[model samples]
Target chain A: MWRDHLTEIIVFSALFLLVSAMGFVAARWRAPKDMAHLDEWGLGGRNFGGWITWFLVGGDLYTAYTFVAVPALMFGAGAAGFFAVPYTIVIYPMVFLVLCRLWSVSHRHGFVTPADFVRRRFDSPVLALLIAITGIVATMPYIALQLVGIEAVLKTMGVTGESALARHLPIIIAFAILAAYTYQSGLRAPALIAFVKDSLIYIVILVAVLYLPYKLGGWGSIFDAADAKFAASANPNDGVLLNANNQLQYVTLAFGSALALFLYPHSITGVLASRNRDVIKRNMSALPAYSLLLGLIALLGFMAIAAGVKPLPGAKEGSVDSNTVVPVLFDQQFPDWFAGVAYAAIGIGALVPAAIMSIAAANLFTRNIYKEYLKRDASPAQEANVSKITSLVVKVGAVACIVFLDPQFSIDLQLIGGVIILQTLPAVALGLYTRWFHRGALIAGWAAGMGLGMWMLYQIPNAATGRKHFGGSAFPLADFGFDTKKTIYVGIVAVLVNLAVAALVTLALRAGKVPDGVDGTEPDDYFVDESDPRVTPGPERDADSAREPVA
Target chain B: MTAPDPEAPEAPTAARSRAKDRSPWNWLLFIPIVVPLIPAFFNGDSPRLFGFPRFYWLQLAWILLGVTTTTVVYQMTKKKRGGGR
Candidate 1:
């Protein structure tokens, strides 16, 4: 069976090689005159226009995980998985208002990381450090999820499992190549590679959505098959449609996920790299084109059912490996050559965002951690070098996440990361519009949110594996007695705690006559455009001129 | 370095920029927000569109709706007049 896939492997490798070459050559695609500067390397010179920004942000946001996991969830659990479609839909409007303001302020101040904006906004390095740490921590599991996506594809391709180490060898090699180009090229590598990733994904999804249903008789038969299988399952909540019990989970999950998606440093990396607010706005609306694609991609779960595709032999008897359903489905339904294209799409889909994610996390470390703490006098060149090296370290941590942890846990940890990152919303997202919350209050809010979020996540356990913890996002709303079956998203619960703490603490701090921290931003900073004269960086206005160079 | 205090006097141009920032077109941003929230109003499976469940098809339609509304808002608000910065 494995040997028969030789043609698929060759096509997959050929496309993989093509993208890897593109990743390396991207270093010179938009050659910066002074490539040594941190902004130039860390952010693709922070000047991408609407078209490039669309692809970059699309590729960054709709990751390989979307390709592999969302449908997998639909295949395994039914209606709950479709939450991703609504989440992606609402995300643009959610971010459109907030992110443009962020871009304006960050650009005006020459801030590279969101933590940089927080530090300047609240005048608290400790708060900034917490935000920075949260970003780095949240990003690790996310990058791990991407690796899980690639590993699933590789496993489906029959290239894994010679030995324990041999199983991960392909993943390590793929990411190592990712790390090298990202180290050499920084944000530019992913920006250039995004073009290819998005194109291949569009082609594969467009073809699959059109071709799959016809092969399976039509949408009617596909839903009928899905409904029959789900109805026979033990879980009463499982079905082809949402039930009273899961409907609230769907709404809260979609809303919470929408709120949390752009808070990640990688999403911000994509947003801040755009040339102007207009680019950001234009891309936000247009990028829903991917959501349409995602909706179709998710239906592959139903297609898998209609095709009678089952989990591979290695999966535990009588249970499904949800992650493998889509890959196995494609393998069963498509000819070897097109299946190769589909597999390559998922594989390369992982690389683009992983590269961008590492760069974003590295920027958080260098700008907020290394520069702010260890060496305030670091030069631009030094900063760039530190970020490049940190990108590599970040990738190593991601590889560690997938290598050492159970793949299921890595998936759950992603939700936990969202819970952690949403804690920053009070300080980072709100601070863009108001600084009324005292810095002390914001810190307390973050602590409350992070603490409560982790506790809830720890309590949820997997029924299938009998695992005691890190099972999933749906936590029982114990406070609402007799409704234990009704669960809310962990992120929504945590952010509520964050907001309550912030509000109470802010009022108390105000009553006590506590002095607020210095606000470093001006009102005008939130509305500046590229053509604005104040942002044009004259000799006297050079944003980086004040920092003293350190050896 | 910290800017002085929020209590410090703002320039007239800055105040004017703040006022202008509240464009009527900014109100259009709520469309994306409202469209997604519509699912909660009619969350059921009975009204299946072409065999796709209502809960499913409604959300998918909103995806395109979100894109269209955002595009209109973006076009209207893309050009900025004189502002404080």
Candidate 2:
């Protein structure tokens, strides 16, 4: 099998090794004087200019999983899958309005994680602990899903074997390299590598969208083929157009996902690493260009259908993994060498977000869990050391998730991941804007939201996979005694329940004269720019102080 | 730097108030979020563009609209600097 695809394998390995070398070299890209602080290691010294910020955040948001899964979703479910386009479209405006506040306040207060901000804002370590744990839990499965993206490409490249060890060995080797560089270089590794990842993705996708249509009839025939296939299908939800049953799910899923996008610790890690508010503002407007690319990417699903691309067989007999559709599509149509580049685009694409996500989760652990609770007085060097180690542990756990559990299970958990992170919205996103909720009330609201979200998810059934429950994110309204077959997104429903509980609890607490947690942040803190004198100094000054001889 | 005293009287009131004032331009952010979500507007298959259905083409168009709205808002609301970087 390997001998058959020697050309593709050689090209893929060459590009992969090139990026790994760059990952190690990235540690000295900006060459900070000291590398033993959380700011230096975890956030690229927190001074990335506009272009780096653009690529970093863009690469962070549009992961390899998105490259594979969005097209796969488009292939399987037709119009319902197109929700990702609107989801990306709606996120930039929300980010523009909301996240700059988070960036400014986090910089002003030296808050490393959203939980760090929550800890200071609500003045409650317990609440901060909840936020931190939620972020880390929601993130692990997401990192595992990135592995699924690479696995799809590998399977397409014929790197499979009968033994389990043979199947997972390549992934292990790739992630070990990723873990080493991320541990050494931290956020800088992914920041520097994203340029290469995005460039390859653009070239491959632009070429595919332009060339594939011309090869397989045209866009009109592609749409016609997709339409005819779905029209003959039994599922009411499958079509080139949205139907009455799934329309509500489409809108809510789009909006709910947009709300949840930046709430993820990785997204915030990308945002807070920017040099200033203007870097964020400029990137917000510019980043929507990726949405255009994403829209084109999603259309690859229809292209796959037009090209008659069939997914490779799965590990189980009589089962096929739809995730392999795009990879197989490229392998079948493109020549041997260009197909190799497309595969490398996907394989390398996985590395950038995986590095950033592990770093983000590690930052949450170090700041909120290890430092806040484990040792209150841990020095900066110690905190950075703990973070570097914790990032390695997170990657190992992500690998374990892929090895022990079925890949389908991780995808389901990622759906729940979005829902779980959205529960933090009231605490983190809204907290950036207001201080109305009591700390205890926010905790109660979190419990209510999370409990309801999980229970709703448990009630969902995936008919295609033949799973009874915990199968998907679309919860049927009929469960609530409604007569219709319409389903709403589980995250939207749970978040609403969460907000109502929070509002009522806040009112009762206020009427009872319960004292609120002291807000550690000032109003002006949210508007501080890079040139502002009140902004916290970067790591260089701290490194200078540490290098001084003891008095 | 030491942590600020939580009870200290608020300084930078001008900057605070300026940040608080809701610019009308900021309201443009809602257009992208709200417009694409209304199902009745872009749900049909009529008026296809470039061999694409109305639903397909319109969603892509909404992306362009979102980019434009964000760019306009960013330009309008950005604080004018006295000295360029």
Candidate 3:
């Protein structure tokens, strides 16, 4: 038993040690003489161009969350979980259209995060604060979702074998390493490690999707196996594709996820760090290629059924923890050493995004909330220091997510998070195009939408975990007792509500002679190139950084 | 180090220079990717349509498809995008 897991522990631990050693030395990877400014610490010298940004963003977005949860969902409930594939496929076109605009505007102003863009675009620090807070709030559970992937892998290896300490020890040790290096190196460590993380993942997914089916049976036999079991399955809850109740979930989940995908500050941070608009444009078109891979990866869920891969005991017999399905599929079916490779891919996958999320969260507190409220005159070096320290704290919150919350619940929280982050779409995405809505109305709209989204999610419950938090619930079938099964994305519904409220209030405020915040951007700035001298680094204006280096 | 300007008047010239370096194989990569997609959209279950069962043939055709698509994209693109380089 230990042999199965031992190889994994050795390989993973050694790799982590090696990565951390590299991380401690990473400040010297391309160490700037004095690494005190935001440029050096926060954005990895703000010099990642087309290829580097490609690998970094690709690695960051399609993470351990996609790896473990997609298959687990497929394993548990059949086709309902495969929405991740199409969502990913569709996401490219979506981002391909929007990301370049963001890149241009961000480059023009030297915005480090989306909130930074909002503050500059609208000339409203309050609006940027709302966006920043939304980003941090939405991103917390996402970092936790990465840990769930590691835990699922650990649980499969039997390292967690009946001991609570065993179950959690790996997570804590790994996060400790993560927090340490992230504190020391900022984005460079993850950016560097992303190369190895992505290579291993491509190898694992390419091989497993190809090899596993061949080993079990051909695709024919595999799907035959899946069809046989699902048809005869004991769980009445099971279906090959989504039913009426689950249909809303599929659409809403996909749509909400698309909106949320770019909205998350971590995702935007990755985009903003690109060296040019063309890089963003190229990556947007290119990133969807992962969707092809994702579709194949999602097949692992159905493949699990075909292989007659059963979930472990303690969870429902039919409903295996969707989180464990991918790890179990690899561990059980692949060779021991190779499974170690697979485990490493997943383990490393967790780190890059966690680092980015922590960075994004810490930047928010330091820039928008702290600098805006607490210390207006903090130095670049001081703000960078605060962001670094706060990054460690953000990681602790992610760790708590794994230690306490159910893995399945984290998935749902991510979904709810999508809804939460989407409320800022108008103030953020739409505001990129126009600042027509008043800042007060936008804030009011955000509060109303967020409140209503949470309320709706809270009222609905999943039969699986049976809790009443943001994660376990879905949008109810018929609001106000309407009979339409035609449901909506919670995020979309929230944003619509947000937009309506903002417009109404904007009209009301205008009628009442109230003042709206001043706009700070010029028309050409939206189309500005990376060489525009006016780009202010961070939020401050100084000779060293007309744009805040950290921003 | 270059004056921290966001606008580059030189960008248009750079983009034009890049267009010349674009890979000839870029369109070729799509062939492999799109070929199998065709069968997936159509019925592979028509045994009369092919030698192997649709299910049996789906991914084998796809491995070729992936390799072809990757190769074509690799051949055509000006720079390595998805880690091949």
| lDDT values for all models | 0.84, 0.89, 0.71
Give the runs in model 1 whose Cα sits over 4 Å from its true position.
A313-320, A479-484, A537-551, B1-20, B38-42, B79-85
For candidate 2, chain B by itself scores a TM value of 0.70
> For model 3, how does the per-residue alpha-carbon lDDT over A101-186 read when each residue is reduced to its tens digit?
78777666556688877887666788888898889888888899888878777778777645555668879989999899888888
True contacts kept of each: 0.57, 0.66, 0.00
Question: What are the iRMS values of all candidates?
Answer: 3.6, 3.7, 8.6
Deviation in Å, model 2, residue A360 alpha carbon: 0.4
Error of 2 at A52 (Å): 0.5
TM-score (C-alpha) between model 1 and the true structure? 0.94
> Regarding DockQ, does 2 or 3 come out ahead?
2
Error of 3 at A81 (Å): 1.2
**TM-score of the second chain in each model?**
0.59, 0.70, 0.42
Give the candidate number with the greatest lDDT: 2
lDDT of 1 at A210: 83
Clashing pairs in 2: none
TM-score of chain B of 1: 0.59
What would you estimate as the lDDT of candidate 3? Answer: 0.71
Judged by TM-score relative to the true structure, which candidate is superior, 1 or 3?
1
Most accurate candidate by TM-score: 2
